[model samples]
Target: MLVNSYGLNGMGIEAIKLFDKMPRELIFEETYVCVLNACSHSGLVDHARSIFFNIINKTEKIYTTMVDCLSRAFLFEEAQILINNFELHHSPSPTMLMSLLSGARNKKDNHLSEKIYIRIEEKFPKHKNRLVSASILLSNAHASVGDIEKSLNIKNKLYQLGLKKKIGLSFTEINGQIFKFRAHDRSHPRSKDIYAENDKISNELIEHGHQFDSAWITRLLDEDETIASVLSGHSERLAIAWNFVANPNTKQIQITKNLRICGDCHQVTKLIAAIRQCEIIVRDANRIHHFYTNGQCSCQDYF
Candidate 1:
């Protein structure tokens, strides 16, 4: 709880300091998980690598965590080397591949993603979930960097395989009620108001010189001119919009996401926090990001 809380606040150094002081016998696998995570968010590459290589008889999960730490720090080559050296006791792990691919995605390195996929294919050729999911990842990475043709072809192949990309979801709670949302969602009873308020927020952001980029959006929807419309419908935005609609008295708003928070949304959240004079906390798959009303985020934009 302590390490996670520090990480959640984007205080990686504090988390690291606390974890490092514990005796070796008292430190368990889970402790390293948190420590590595803290290091990743803090961009402590040297510290993370040290922890990675120093762990005794590291388990696969620990190896994966260290990979994530390196990936988050943009140490792609080192991360791949670590993965390659691991003596696998079973079939290749899809999550590790996905993590590496995410690192590639950050750098928009399509070739690297393809190479990683080829490696996965060689080892686990028949793993349905692994292949399809990785194909989708490769598609997104290419598309994000404006290689629409490659992305579309991968999507078409996914269609041939009858695998659909899982819809990303984000959730929030208000007035003791839980709300679920998706992209372009209109099923909510107050969707009309929600969408309207979302537009209002978007207009505000644009007026402040906020420029949306394709890197933070899905390559699928980002190719079109309707990018603004698409961005307005992001689940996290909708959740925050709902809070504005009904919970104006709240000083801080916290949201939880099932997937990684896109860069576009992250930027928008920062602008929103400043404009509205409120603090927001977002817990996405990668790490927790805190948006302060002063146009600052806890993750320091590293995540």
Candidate 2:
């Protein structure tokens, strides 16, 4: 009724107010979760905190939801403190732990990352999911710090545990057309045309004083000669190749990926954005990284 009569903004405020008027003892875990989600959407940090504390007498699921909301908002330290002080016997759910680690990674807080890993180990030593999460975090943090060998070693350990990282891929929809590509994928029907276009764009960018940083490519390939070719096969490149083929003059491209964007890929995308005179929005595991012609990314290289 409120939405039909007053509209979205008014209805939302009215709904929240109505929920807030409920007696404290009557408020339930699901109610708290809903309020936490509202806080996340509306950026109501103080309200979220109040609701979180009020829900303390409720359930662990409510606490988990609060942790997730805080982490998603980049309040890693606060989330950590809340989780630690709760004295919950078991640690945060693996999903919550993953969110915390993701938030820390976004902030490039390796110290926090290490603490999270140690906590996970202590709390859930036999949990394979936590182990995989820790491995991925360590590998990514090591790679970010330029310790490529250590990063690869961490990945190798994960593999030994029978938990290899999923190959990252991306897909983009432009002008009602969908294009997909995986890391080093060459199975697309338009692979030949895509390569030809990528070659042309890469050459033009090089001529315009842009250098392709193929560090991730080098890490993936066993042979030195395959590095350049492999990098060209990355998902971002595939998206760009499709963009060129479908809409050569488009000013913006949006791509979504299933995993964290590699450091080298991040740098390369920024260069590509500048060279192509376009803005690229990449949604990865954590958040959106927007690249523009100013040779900068939205994350400031934190991820």
Instruction: Choose the strongest candidate by lDDT.
Output: 1
Best candidate per TM-score, number?
Answer: 1
Cα TM-score per model:
0.75, 0.58
Candidate 1's C-alpha runs over 4 A off are: 1-10, 88-91, 125-127, 166-182, 186-192, 206-211, 216-224, 246-263, 270-303
Residues 192-258, candidate 2: write the lDDT tens digits. Answer: 8888998887677567665545334314446654545666667877887888778889899999999
- Candidate 2: list runs displaced more than 4 Å: 1-28, 89-92, 168-180, 187-189, 195-303
Can you list the residue pairs that collide in candidate 2? none
The lowest-lDDT stretch of 10 consecutive residues in candidate 1 is: 1-10
Measured by TM-score, how close is model 2 to the native structure?
A: 0.58
Q: Which ten residues in a row have the lowest lDDT in candidate 2?
A: 1-10
